[model samples]
Target: MPKTTETTLEINLSALTHNYSYLKSKLESNTNFLAVVKAFAYGSDSVAVAKHLEALGVDYFAVAYTSEGFVLREAGIKTPILVLHPQPTNFKTLIDHCLEPSIYSFKVLDEFISTASHCKQQDYPIHLKFNTGLNRLGFRASDCNNIVEKLKATAAVKAKSIFSHLAASEDLNEKEFTLHQISTFRAVAKNLESLIGYKPWLHMCNTSGVIHYPEAHFDMVRCGIGLYGFGNSANEDQNLNPVASLKSVISQIHKIKPNETVGYNRAFMAEGHQKTATIPIGHADGISRQYGNKQGFVFIKGLKAPIIGNVCMDMIMVDVTNIECSEGDEVIIFDGIHKASTLAESANTISYEILTAISQRVKRKFLK
Candidate 1:
């Protein structure tokens, strides 16, 4: 493969397919798989990623906002898209685009009911989100009666699914808590069904939830990080291939004498003579400032180069003194060899943040 002169995010579609297959294999044949393509397909390419997954026959697609679904719909993507956080104001647009909204609260439910009715639409498929334990979104279990009342009052909207988020599905320590959440979600789903005279598709498992709680795989499973190559567990991570690789070229190299400083605010003061390589990527490109000043390292010639000084808007300097590297040499910020999970750990974050933080300004190269 030829090295690119600029920083690029390389997305491997084959690896993504492999991950999809692996995760799908974990599910029962009747269970539907929803590929979470929000946040630009976790900062890769939403159109590209969703298109490939669509081709693979994913049962559903999810995005954080309606605009994301709009992009896919415009691109001729025929898959059903679930808008996780649908604002009341975008109800009309969502309806027009054939996008389903996850109605998590009574206010949203009532508002959407009114909107759908005013639009004279009937049986518009809407998902009901219950707040079992995540508490971040979704209606409370106590709000189930009110939800049923509102839906019964309006024929404009129909419940398509009842789902909730798992707070810590990846942590073994939270196994008890996860089970409790599942139980609570099940009760909520049952209560809503009895009140409404029907049971919607019940889903509560995310990527880790699907891996750790196989029994919780209800009607469908929503997979986000796992599709882009992360399993949230050592054993599962080994089974999945990371789909994205961040690479750049060393633009310049400098030899700094003792006491010389580098980068903004002179954050890095050399103790002895040192060599550094500056790459054209920084916080603006999704490499957070927290990874600067010895906090993180990049791979050069299969060697580790610690980052030195502050990470600038478009530049980052790394200590490459011990490494046999020169300008124009390819550098790996995070790839299969230099896992994003490791880089994220150094920044006290998760791989999802690292992957999604990659800015849209950086060119994305897709490999099939």
Candidate 2:
């Protein structure tokens, strides 16, 4: 048996595979599935998630940095890893590990080319990123000339894939805007292809785009949050199984008198006589401090327990007055039943924030 901790992060691999297959079914057979495993696989466990996705025959894996890609390489992951935000400082390490970098800006492209040449590397695969509309990291669509010029001039670097990110693929209200972005990307891609005399694998849609605009399934689709089984909108199908569950044991229970205060700075005041359960989890464990003051809740004995006071670095007090729970009983912060969405909503955030915000200090337990 695996060693038990005060708090447990349960990763359901079967659910992951199911989610992958679910997204795969939505795309054409020719469309490659690229799994985004950055942020430690959305703060679950990148190595495990990447391994599972690799075993499930995912065509590619993407991470935010070279270090994340290195982790997969060390784990013997043979799948191509695209570094979404590759830095020049890590260019050597990235080349050493056979990791591909996404050339977002001209500066990054030059740095990568220079580094690869210094290392005596030849024709290293690299993905080109177009900004489209995200306003984040990516080359501007109008700047295709510069990209094409560089690629044509440089024989040391090779274009593996060309891609862009959708800003709001899930919002139907933004459908018109999304379409414009898609059109722009398509035009830029066509121009680049014509200029380069070759068609690099083109991908643009994210998880939300894959569901809402299936036609945008270009050459590949990147799925991140969806892989953990949460749709972009509640209106979409809810068949995707949630892959992660968080459970923490109540370490202490106390009966507070009316008008008593709880936690640091007395953020939560008792309405009446209440029983409070202190759990061994707090912001330090990924639960945010914004969830303090009874705004956030957890499941105890199938009942809602309002979190009281400030979510400290190491613990959180819950108003468990009516719940039939004990010191050693498990409390569900987020699971299939509670839904990570519910928690994020309570904290005025999205499920992505809640799931990815989970701290690294907590233990991860994988369930196949």
Candidate 3:
């Protein structure tokens, strides 16, 4: 990869391939792999990532919304796409696109069945989302009989998979709660299978569960962050690589004398002579106001330059006083080596927020 001359998000397909293989290695030979490519593939180019993963033989793809799946379909993604959350309004559009929906509630399930029936569809695949412990969008484990009853009354929909989300599969401290969730999911799958008279794909593990709990991998595992990097633990993180790196170039350099203030609100007043670099990325570009006033740093010429003052909407001033860098020099916002997790930590957040928060306007460059 060449040095970035402007604000760019580099998506490394090779890194994605490696991450995918690493995650797949933890699963059984017959287990399915569902790649979660929502939120613009965690703010990298979704089409590019999905196309590459499709070539790598991912069993399925999961997106948060129907529109995301539509985008994938537009990109010619042929593998099955599971829309994790589908609104009643998009049920028609979802059916038109042949995207499967996760039937979480009786309302959503009923609406989808009606939509599918009205569309004259038969046995349209839909995943059953059970609320084991996430307490988010899912049907209760006790709702198994209701789901069975609903399925029996309709040929418009079919339960292709039964799944749930692990609230804290990455946190070992929540092992007991996680275990309970797993058991509940298992019981639901068993009861549902008995009632439905057939087996649907059973999955509960997310990225962290793939790393921490292989026994819960079940029939399929949905991996999101781990596929992009950061394994939710220091030990596991060492094994995966981040697929995206946000880079920019210094737009200008400023030489400030003692007592000179910089940026909005005079938030940073130089105590001594300082040199600052204004990079073309800020709150609007996903650098966020939270990472201002020396709370964050970017790597320039392989040296750390702390952000000096308030983060502007379109730019930020970093104290590059000691660095021997010039205008157009490459600036590393966060890369595999620097790690978005570290920058996110400095901002009192996590890797997911920073990674997915990246602005879509940033020009994407891919490393094949």
Candidate 4:
């Protein structure tokens, strides 16, 4: 791999496969696995990730929007693709590409039914999302009867699966709440099954849910961040290999005397003499302004270099006074050593946000 001056997100396909295998080991032999490749596979190259997972025999792939699934389909992905949030306007495109939709509400169900009928589609597979506790998206428990009635009323669509989201699966303190959610989902699934005369695959476990609530694995499991090498907790994260490494070169170095300021808005003033290095990536590349003002740090020659000032659109300045580094030397923003979770914590966010926020402008290199 040739080195480049610009920032690059290096994706290790081998680590991705390792993560998948490790997560699969947590499930029963018969249980199915659904890989969430939404948000460009959490901002690491969706098609590449999806293709690799597909090759590894992922039972299903899910994306946040219809267009995301369409992109996968266009790339010759034959595995089943689920559109987690489907819009009424894209129903035609969804069917045209053989993509499934998660019908979470009455409006979505009604709209999809109408669209499927217009397209003359028979037994179109669609998943029903229930609001067990998250209360974000999903039909209420009361909506079960209505959902069953709607499905019985038309053969245009079929219930491919029934699922829900666990709001706090990772928090051990929220174990009771997670259990309640699992119980609620179970009851909802039973009700829908009795009404429909059959059970579609029932699933409600994300990565954290899979690790903490193995009993709630249901008929299928959805693994998102876990596949990207994070387990949501330190103990669990230890077993997974981080797949992406954000790397760049120190473009320039500056020596500032005492009382001199650095970066825009004078965000950092040298307490004494200081050495700083400017890297080629900044807010535009998804290193948010929230990471500035010394809130975040990067690794240079295996030493810490705290961010010194406001993150600019195309660059950032870091105090490298202690680190013995030079221009063109490698800088590690977040990798195995400098975990994305650590950076996210400093930025008052989560690893998911940090990973997905990495802009498309940053080139992605896949390592097989």
Give the TM-score comparing model 3 with the true structure, all chains together: 0.98
lDDT of candidate 3 over 1-368, digit per residue (tens): 56688899998999999999999989999999999999999989889999999999999999999999999998899999999988999988898889999999999988999899999989899999999888888998788888899999989888899999999988999999999999998998999999999999999999999888889998999999999988988888899999999999999999999999999999999999999999999998899999999899999989999998999999999999899999999999999899999999998999999999899889999997
**Shift of residue 301 alpha carbon in model 2, Å:** 0.5
lDDT of 3: 0.92
Error of 1 at 123 (Å): 0.5
For TM-score, candidate 1 versus 2, the one ahead is 1
lDDT of each: 0.93, 0.90, 0.92, 0.94
Q: For residues 89-129, what per-residue lDDT tens digits would candidate 4 score against the true structure?
A: 99999999999999998999999999999999899999999
Candidate 1's displacement at residue 172, Å, is 1.0
Model 1: residue 303 alpha-carbon error in angstroms: 0.3
Q: Write model 2 residue lDDT over 135-222, tens digit each, in one string.
A: 9988887888888898877778989989999999999899999999999999989999998899899999899999998878999999
Q: How far in Å is the alpha carbon of 44 misplaced in model 4?
A: 0.1
Q: Worst ten-residue run, lDDT, model 3?
A: 1-10
TM-score, predicted candidate 1 vs. hidden true structure: 0.99
- Candidate 1 residues 1-368, lDDT tens each? 87778999999999999999999999999999999999999989999999899999999999999999999999999999999999998999999999999998778888998889999999999999888888799888888887888888888999999999999999999999999999999999998899999879989899999999999999999999999899998788899999999999999999999999999999999999999999999999999999999998899999999999999999999999999888999999999768999998997988999899999999999888
Candidate 2's TM-score reads: 0.97
> Higher TM-score: candidate 2 or 4?
4
